[model samples]
Target: MTIRILLDTDIGPDCDDVGAVAVLHALEKLGEVRIAGMTHCTSSQWGAGCLDALNRFYGRGDIPIGTLTMPGFLDGDSGYAKYNKGITLGYPNRYQTEPAPDAVETMRKVLAEGEDGETVIVAIGPLINVMNLLESEGDLYSPLNGMQLVSAKVSMLIAMGGHFPAGKEWNFEMHPASAAYVVAKWPTPIVFSGFEIGAPIHTGRSLTADLPDTHPLRKAYEWYVGEGETRHSWDLTAVLYAARGHHPFWELESGTATVDAQTGANDWKHNPNGNHAYLKAITSPSLVAEVLDNLMTR
Candidate 1:
């Protein structure tokens, strides 16, 4: 059965987000998933633009793209201006317009529209949007917010956040409070594609070399790979794991997660208290190469 997926992403930090979208499109083609909606959680002017560009590239422009209201940070600077400054670097023409709809509201609408227990949330960015949903609607969705939500409204929350062994990672670090809130309060099963899993799967080379510049994916990839360097496929791993349960590069484990209240680090231990999937990294260079090749070709 095809899983209904709501993709929450932060596309501008690195170009691999583009590749992640490509992988999602491929999964849709394979009939393994459906694109319910997309929420951009970077809380930047360019965040929405990045989402729009990717959706347009994949011929999914009609997909609802919502922007977060929370601010974003830079490499190490957790300031609003850092995100605003980064916006100047990509698709300047698109940022001059008004922002898209509120991401939190869009998420609520999507959840309302989904059939009971049928939606899967694949979060490949900051946890702000999901956190907002949980905090605002937790009481009303007590049954559908925690483990019950996991079994009912949500099949799984495949998140590309946190780090293995509970260290700092950008996504989790950016809004550590929100991350902690969502993981602790969420009522569903979560599968984390942390930095340990995605950081290693770097793209070897451009797969769009043969395609003309006019090709949407090709143009997006070209623009993304500005410095003639292969990008890291951080978000794509989450996409792959979500669409195809086995990637030959990840070992899955059932564990309970404990969130550090002060720091956003997540500690996972084997337990029955919560049903969360922690991904352990494995060697799968071949699988990465094959997926990259197929995405570029298709």
Candidate 2:
């Protein structure tokens, strides 16, 4: 019953993506997940390196990471890379170099290496990689093209961007065309961790009180948004559901989620034929916070 996960994230700017990675590793440690690979849609040179440090901190430095090296593809620096240097000062790692294999190929390679219908794609970033994955043709990994390959291997899509019922968010805003395209034609069932879903579940405050100063997550959070402030838990919610799937936590709402191509706004419509669903708040934010902090702290 081990779940294979291909995580796609825009990690540096927001510390939640870091938190999402933490939870992924924690669950992996518990034998609930096997991280297949990580793909970064962010354009920062330091972004991939930061994730490498975290994975290494959790004893999984060998995990494959994909990066978007092309210019203007939501490229920029995440100030949180400042804390990553701390991890490298004491450990050896290969994340500092420019990312290789490119994101699309890296994902294809990850999927190709996995068993059919076992890999789950969890995206907590922009839709850049999703668009590319679907539009891409067959490569050295498999004879199947992008959509076909995904339909064959990946079980579902769990994304962490968008405000339900027609509102714009950062991930969708960055690439509306891609967002719209992905929601409309992606082959598997999709579930969203909406803005409202995780908006109330504040985190980071607990780490400040419980974790040691040497802890990388504590340091990452401290450097990213100061010592006391708590941020919303949007990305973390997606990671939880991706592994647990509304189990002891959430109630699932069935429907199709749509994005406006021009504005990146989203709306949900019920269709038995639709392969989409969005999270409906079930368990309280406090319970979610407790579960997330417990996993992240471990």
Give me the candidate number with maximum lDDT. 2
Per-residue lDDT tens digits of candidate 2, residues 1-298? 8899999998776788888999999999999999999988867666667777788888998899878767766443445355544544434557665454588989999999998898999999888898899998998999899999999999999999888745778888888898999999899999888888888998878788888887878887887778967878889999999888897777777888889888889888876676888888877899998899899888
- State every prediction's TM-score relative to the real structure: 0.83, 0.94
What is the TM-score (0 to 1) of candidate 1? 0.83
Question: TM-score winner among the candidates?
Answer: 2
Candidate 2, position 88, lDDT: 41
Clashing pairs in 2: 166-266
Error of 2 at 27 (Å): 0.3
Tens-digit per-residue lDDT, 1-298, candidate 1: 8988899987666666667777788788778888888887875676676666656666676777787876534333333333233433343324447767778777766776688888889998878778877755443324344334344667678988878756777788767887887787777788888887766666636555655555544555555565235666668888888877755777787777766656777787786555787788767756675676576457
- lDDT assessment of candidate 1: 0.70
Which runs in model 1 stand beyond 4 Å of their true positions?
71-96, 137-152, 214-228
